[model samples]
Target: MIKNSDITVVVQGPVVASPDRAMDEGITEKCLTSVRHHLPGAHVILSTWQGQPVEGLDYDELLLNEDPGSNITEYTADGKPDASNNNRQIVSSREGLKRVKTPYAMKLRSDNYLVGDQFKFLQASFPERCEEDRFLSERVVVNNTFTRAYARSRRVALHMCDFFYFGRTEDVRALWGMSNLPDLAYDQTRNGQKQYWGAPHYKIDCTQKLLLVALQQYDASLNVEHLHDAPDDLIARSERIYANNFVIGEPELIGLGLCSKFGPQERANRLSGRLTYVNFDDWQVLYKTYCDAEFPLGMAPLRIRKRNFLRAFLLAAKLLEEALKRLKKKA
Candidate 1:
């Protein structure tokens, strides 16, 4: 059993007030207060940009880092977004992880807060692992925000959620201890600033880049050149990666409380069943596939997205009707 005292909470990110936030308190204040309320004995570290307002913030220690300005390039090779705070995130989280003294540490966004301590109970859960891929003392706990399911429509490989992480201190450090994004990335000849390669199919987000770097530590030969590199082997490798190295849970189950900006309506539109994001149940399927020896293959079923399917079917029918009318007129 993990005690609250054994954990250090590192709330890293710029403090910015959201219009959706319910309380008038500053974002950092709400975050710190929640840490105090839910994990009373845990140490709290506030890691943010230098010169940010720090007065009245509750924290055992404060780390003010020089803002590594956002890396903004011309449009990507496939013409997608080019601006990302990848460097800023790396600098802030890496510095915070370096200061963690406890056996366990959680990396929470400064804009987010804890609502409960249930995630502590999950630290020791899911003990089974695929011996080959297991790296951490325990699987790092992360919310199911952008942990993509390759089998889903929103398929992408190595897209680990970076919003939060709760696990062994060193393990959490390893996850964030990655090189900052280079100013020049992807096919630079076309745009001279294409920071990422895949667009249309997959945009290499910060989390994806972060996890790819971390995975290379264990498997030096895992050469992923593009964002949409989801071959069957890569897909299976990703499944095992999540199975042995991380636990994906609902934000609530993980004691993570998103700001009001991510309320019910946003969640309903952005996140759905296991098809879009890897929920706890989806993680369980991967766990059984790689960890549980006796678990039969193909037994872990994925839920179908009924509503999306219906929408697609109706759109296809309408398109066919329009095409038929055009053909009759031409005849």
Candidate 2:
């Protein structure tokens, strides 16, 4: 069993100083306090930009570095996403992981905090793996919030969640130590030409890019060109990779607390007893489909069966809704 003392919690990213009276403390301070409350003996490292406020923040070590400037957002007739903090995440996480002397570590966001330590059990729970596809010695536990279930509407490949990760220090380091995102990757305009509008190019989101880069280290032959809307084969390969390398669960089950600023719609969606994202049950099914031997279909858990049924129904409704919208537009 890995004790709290053997784990270091690296809270990386910008500090969230909330002004709400309901939650008086700053998000980063609250995050550290959560670590102390849940895992008493765990070490906490706050890694953020040098100029960020740090007074009264509760952490064992403070790491400050020059801000790796944000990517430039390319505007087109078709709206492109804003500049992501991929570079910031990469630098802060890699540096923080390097400072970790403990056996296990968690890459937590400064805005996020822990509610419990139940996630530790999932770190080494799924030991069975396909030798060729196995990268990490044990599965890294990740939140299901952004871990999409591509079997449904989303067809993203290698779109692993980067929100929070808990695993062996070496494994976490390897995961975040990948190359920084290139300028051309996000900025899809050159010579005043709208490259994103009508041009053949490989585009991938930060989450997909990060995981695919790490996977490439173990299997150089693997190729993931696009972020989402991937081919079926690539999607299957992604499922296999995730099943072998990750344990995805709900935020609450994984002892994660979302910051108040993490959108109210998402918070309500979570509270509605819906299983839209890839939850632990979905991960188990993926594991069985790829890594483990197939069991009787009827033997699957009732909740999983219900979840699948609901997913199918919801997908049908979504398709119908889209069709209706198209008809309305045509009319």
Candidate 3:
């Protein structure tokens, strides 16, 4: 399955436009030479102008001491942009994918850029890393976070714990089932003459709200076993995962795209379509079943069957892929 084309080496980062193409050429040569000792008969790189493999010379037959074509080796492409490496990164043949399992999991990039849970993960793990390089890091963080979370939550399942699902937080407080949200607004200006304001001054309101949502989601999905007193009941549900808001038994998954906003519109001037959820708890099922059936292995059946936070990540990836497919078609 590991085709020669699949095993591609990421040449380097973005091609910096310069008066001299020498920089790129030098880098390419260095990379090929460095990797050659490791990968025998490896394709070097391609011409700086046309990426096609340069032709008309057999290095073994006619030794120009260095043939122009020989100097630059051709790079195998995956027929898709290698989001992992800014440059196109070739995957070994599908058969070869089995070789790199743990530590280096293989992923195929879909058209869309979501990569779902992976996106949120990258944002947190590499808070300082460049935005462009977060794709793979996101997957690593989310995957690692979830694995640890699963281990810690096992004992709590025996004793039913009250989980404050952010999706249901407002509703819970309204019903008095749960107390006011953690950060309740204080009545600093309640003089009876002036109404008591619970809002965080309304100015810091948006920031507070964003922080709350981010924290809730981040804590729920990324907290894991980092702390002994981790917020075990943290529940940050993803719109993609909690998408069961639709009627079941429907044959076709009908969804609407968000229409573009004109002058009077609140959202940006673009039509955004709403996608219906086509899958269910199956997402958690996918991850749980993908490597091994670890879902039913937990001590608690209720928790074991629960989809947890993995659904969000998958949905993000799937949605991005779908979007990319549409763009490709248009192109």
Candidate 4:
């Protein structure tokens, strides 16, 4: 748990890149690494765009700040501009920083980089559907497994510490396979249809949901809580509908336990346990192999939005404080 004195849980990206171009600082990797590096002992979870089950990383449930060895400069990509910074007339965003949150750690992101392979666009298409579950058969899937995998504690949401960008979420380029969901959500939505590309119609929004719920739980009790208010038997039934019982659901899906009776701190504990911090891993292999050679067009993966930084920060802080009051029994 973050000390009452700690203020920022710097959040950052849902960064993107070719599988071969090196995703050293991608969202999953960033979250994993941050947890490993900063929050050392905290349990770390690796998440894909909509919560797909992919793992080469993990989080430990321990805190480093309580110790001295973990002290490091925390900043978003604030140290220097992207690779193009050396050139003149280039529009480099001076604003670069992300709020990084993990079960045991959180920080403002920095130096998170993805090797650019702008020429990989030609290879844009979903893979042949997996005979098992079509969602994972494609390149993306729902990221709810984080909770299912670590069903030991309550997982609350961490509000945006930085910007999160799901790259290629929608492919306007063609009448194609699975378009990137994140990119497509921003597209003009139809009256009824969710802005999407193909079938296997799973909707993704765990990260956002987690944050909203987490912010509301802080300082609310000595344990984790859920929803905007205490749930009567009637209201709790309703929560199961959307959350599908994920974290705060009526049945409470995607949390730390099966015996759903969270008071205050208990619920907060679950949220803290389940949050994933994006970290780095492979991508350069595919970028160099398929993307660079086959298509030579990349999405220029990034998350750009000056407007969200403050909003997310304030919301996160407010939510955390409120939850804290309840958890500490101060509420």
**lDDT of every predicted structure (CA atoms):** 0.76, 0.76, 0.23, 0.25
TM-score versus the correct structure, for each prediction: 0.82, 0.85, 0.19, 0.18
Q: In terms of TM-score, how similar is model 3 to the real structure?
A: 0.19
Task: Score candidate 1 by lDDT.
Answer: 0.76
- Write the number of the candidate with greater lDDT, choosing between 2 and 4: 2
lDDT of 3 by residue, 83-186 (tens): 12111212111112223222222121111011112221222221222222121222211111011111111211111101111111122122112111222222
Local lDDT at 171 for model 1: 95
Q: Which parts of model 3 are misplaced by more than 4 Å?
A: 1-26, 50-291, 294-331
lDDT of 4 by residue, 57-140 (tens): 343221211101111111112322112111100001111111123211222222231122111121223222212211111131
Candidate 4 residues lying further than 4 Å off, grouped into runs, are 1-27, 50-53, 60-331
What is the lDDT for 48 in model 4? 21
Summarize candidate 1's per-residue lDDT along 1-331 as a digit string, tens digits.
Answer: 8999999999998876424224334767888999999998999999998887888788999999998877753374465744667787788999999999999999998878898988878778777777877778788999887676642233467777888999999899998888777764445456643444444444555667678887788789875555667778887888888889888888888999887666666653353433456777677778887898665435335343453464456546656877888799999
Order of all candidates by lDDT, from best down to worst? 1, 2, 4, 3
Clashing pairs in 1: none
* Per-residue accuracy of model 2 over 1-331 as CA lDDT, tens digit each: 7799999999998774323212324878888899999999999999988888899888999999788877543344344534656788888888888899999999998888999898898786676788657788778999887666542344567777788999988888888887777654444344444443113443555677677777788888777665455788877887888888888888898999987745456442553224456777778888888888753335447878887888777777776887899799999
